[model samples]
Target chain A: MPIKSMYVTYSDSIYQFIYFLVGDDELAKDLTQETFLKAINSNPQFRGESSEKTWLSKIARNLVYDHFRRKRLLKFIPFLHEHEQIDYTYSPEQWLEAKNEQYELYEALGKLPHHYREAIVLRKIEQFSIKESAQILGWNEAKVKNATERGMKKMNELLGGERDA
Target chain B: MLDSKLRSLERKTLDEETKNSQLLKLNKRNKDYMKKQKFTYSVTLVLFGLLLFVFSQTITESPKSIQSQQLTNFELGEVTKAYYLYSKRADRMYNLTSPFYTDKIFTTDPAVLNEFELLFKNSEWLPFNGDLTKYTTSINYLFQLENGESVYLKEINEDGFFVNPNTMMQTKLAQQSHEQFVFYWMHIYMGKNEFPPWKIGLLTILLLIFVYAAIKSNKRGTIEKNSSLINLSGLGLAFFCIHKMNEWLGVNHLLTLLLIFTFFMSATVYLHILIKKQEPNWKYHIQRIFMANIVLFVLFI
Candidate 1:
């Protein structure tokens, strides 16, 4: 299909997925745009091995990792962090309040390690089938199932510990 | 309760304005990409046409196509003043027939003349259009007759074809002639030691692209930028390197392309590592420019 229609149909889902990964709404929106651009740029090699949605989700996921990698770079350049633009639009506190429910659980989810967050988001939030999640995450179905269970367990532990504090 | 909240969390999507705006941006980029693809296709087509025109087969003299003024190999006889005429410039082209061109190499030796004679025996010619020098590097084979008449056959150029003496027709020397003539010309021009025009143009383009990409990358101050200029040149080099390696190693082009692409990704990752370690700004900037040019040269060539 032509890219415009593809973008219209998938951009929202891609954006939503990135938002889950990064926990920043505005950044998610930007990443969604980047996902579609990458799709267009690499279109010639799209062998139709998977559904377009899965392919786009994978692209979105990769962009999120890229975003994290760049952010991680700031750890070495502490001074650079001062100059960094902090977008509070989707900070855990603000995002939890805006959503008006699941405050502790959502914050705990944000604190999960990247792999677990990825698994939980794809499996629960996006509601992709195990097979589809595996395809998008480039993981095996067993790994996806393991990650989701552990991720949920860890999330609850964090939620409980926070409440006790 | 946790599952329920999670379900609720999964439910949100981008607002309409954001989604629609993104779509518009994608459509614009898609349009530009289409235009670029078309332009690249045209360039590839023109290059292909030039190649076919250049190395085109010599026309075999046939009874039906013979003309009274048509110069055939048989009518051309033994000569005393045979010289291989060539000039780095095209304007000095036909002037070689008068020994007025700046560069001329004598090839009147019997063995070399025999090679030319045998190569052109019953030569086939085709009517051609355009000045060869504008598009290709070619040289003239001046078979100067003892009587002062000169038959100037353009030895096929780097593009693998050259011009007929009549200037109206183009001909391809046999592959053997092409090689032998090249062997002779290499002796004279190899010492000229100047970069070929195409090389100069390619280097200039690579430098410009590298500089432009570096400036843009620095201005953004974020490593997240994915300028098409960088991608285009990077991929260009990747494909070129793949092709060259394929020739050397006989590996698949696609496979080699993937390997080279991986190298690029690794370099980007390494850059991140460097940035994380807070490499000196000057060093970072210099490496950034160097990396950009390496990809550009690999990509552009």
Candidate 2:
């Protein structure tokens, strides 16, 4: 497929996936573009053994890994901290209701170990099947199941589920 | 409640402008990459063609020279012009030779004719088949015949011609006096030249770039050709560059060790970038390598 049409078809889905992983509209937009760019640049002959959506998810996941790697590398230099801004696209009523609760939850998701966060996003949030998540994340089926289960419990714990109780 | 929040979070998709703008960026990047790929292919073809041409020229000597060798026994009535070069590099002679010189054979003793006949009869041709690009010859004899053709052997030293092992060139050379050798060295156009074997390194670099680009162009979906090409080419490029770097530095010293280590580090990082399927900064790596080479050259030579 010509790259433009392919992007038009899958850009939103990929962008949303990246947005949830990155928790920033602008960075997610950049990485979404980076996903397609990396795919075409590095592997132009993507024949879709898995669906194109799966292939794109794989690329976006790699970009997220790279993003966190750079972030981790930057952690050593104490003064350089990125003030991550949370800007969600929402109607006014949804924004008022979600402004505090969803913001904290999304921040918690971002703070999760990347693997867990990725599994939770793919499994619980994006609704990818366990097998599909395995294919995308390059893990075995059982690993995917374990990560999803552990990831959901971790997310609840991160939101003070046990602490509040 | 967790499932509901996760569902609600999924509902918050990107705004339309961001999606469309990103589509435009992807479109632009795709077009840019296609252009870059075409450029890489064209450059690689041209470099490979150049390499083939140089080797071919080396292996296949000028047919006219071969024809002249056939007529070596065609003794001349009178020589037109003659001047022999002295202490010269094979590289410079192959690159350029003045067509205005004649053999000192005519300016010497008349008994030289008998000497020439003897030289031809008992001539022991040393067949040196080294590549002309890197091969250095202490060539001296350059002769202009009646037909204005230069009979200059590529591997000519102070004594005689060394024929290419591949060629059927059986030309013989008479031992010349020291006076005659010095006479030609004093010529206005001919002088000693110092030729660096830089072209070999260049062709090596070009071949590497061709292979490296071939590796990158290999697609991921095809495991058979793709992964092997990447691993082999990356390793080969690293190996060849290391060898070439040693040859270039020409000394087993600190600088050479430092440079090779630095180079291997960059290559390892590049391998990581490829393995991870990160956005390929191949052009960055290529430029960095080429720049490192240029810098090393400037600093050393």
Candidate 3:
């Protein structure tokens, strides 16, 4: 694919990845735009050491880390409005009836610990291969697989497995 | 059965509804980001060009001398000789005005000492005149006042004060006079010379450049890259101190001391910034110490 078309095609997937990490629609949109702008303006010698998708994902992840660092989130966890109690469980029929599961999924992702949330976003939402996720995240493949498994198990515990529909 | 069902749900593909919404959002955001980046880059370019123009103009201008040739004549010889002799005796103080009398006194020829002396005596100046015997060899007159203050006046030929060619005193004196004139003019008259003002302006321009670079990096979401601006600011500050020290102390003992201290402090702070990888809080402390030193030096001057 030409570089421009490839960028356009992958842009929304990158946005979904950032949305999964931040759990705020506006902020995720902003970060996603920033991620692609950076990728396009960067020196063209990307050399494919990893897939373009993985490289862009790494840039998105770094931007998310920077946002949290600036917000000093670790120092003010209790004050985070996004972490307030929410109704996670849903009857199967009710889940089918809701118009937007994406927002719900995003909020639940935000409440997860950083490592687990990152693993799930890469593995489940981005649907990156386990090896690609590990490379982008600077983790071993075993660690990536373990974190994804643990993150999904924790998600089951949070939502109580009622909305598999 | 539950695990298989969960797997199937997780594997669901992106429907047209979600894909279209994501594309619309991405397109709007990308446009906004590109516009912001372009605006920032243009502003930076214009500022950089303006600074360069100002600095270049400053460097190309001529330097003006501060010493007056009118003060070097034989008619003013007596007053000038007395001033220099007094200054030398007073631990090299730079002020040439009389400590005894507030006004200047003029005399054309120094050979007629009694004429000058009689003029003072008729004014009822009752201060000590050591003896008249010294006046016979060279025209010497003791200008004495009732307040017990005296200045020994001497005659000079057409030849003026002899200055040694190899002495550093002449160079330092010239620099000191220029600096004094520049400082006085800047503070009292809102005027500035090309050299000092240019140097100060250039350093300020460099500081702004680094700050802009940092902001650009921040906008691009690169915080670590922005740290380079902090380092650049630190270096610019060190150069500023060197420039100020050159003006204040000249190229002499005091200047040497300032140079060594400035280098040592700047290097130490640079190392700290690079090694610790923390926000350079120590740079502010170092700047405070340097400022205190400048205050003390200026007070002495």
Q: Which one is best on lDDT? A: 1
Give the Å shift of residue A52 in candidate 2: 2.0
DockQ of each: 0.18, 0.19, 0.07
lDDT ranking from best candidate downward: 1, 2, 3
Task: Write down the worst ten-residue block by lDDT for model 1 chain B.
Answer: B57-66
Give all candidates' CA lDDT scores.
0.60, 0.56, 0.48
Chain B fold agreement for model 2, TM-score = 0.34
- Among all windows of 10 consecutive residues in model 3 chain B, the one with the lowest summed lDDT is B163-172
Q: Looking at candidate 1, what is the lDDT of residue B201?
A: 75
Best by DockQ: 2
DockQ of 1: 0.18
* Model 2: per-residue Cα lDDT over A1-165, one tens digit each: 557777878888898788777766678878988888877764534544677788789878767766766777435444213312222232222443457776777777777766777788888887888877987777789989997778788888889895233
Off by over 4 Å in 3: A1-7, A15-51, A58-117, A120-146, A149-165, B1-35, B65-301
* lDDT of candidate 1 over A1-165, digit per residue (tens): 668778878877887788777777778878889988988766543445678888788878777756766776434444323322332233553545755446655677677776788898888888899998987776679989998998888887877744323
Candidate 2 is scored at a TM of 0.45
Higher-TM-score candidate of 2 and 3 = 2
Query: What is the C-alpha lDDT profile of model 1 across B103-140, one tens digit per residue?
Result: 44564567756655666665576666666446434655
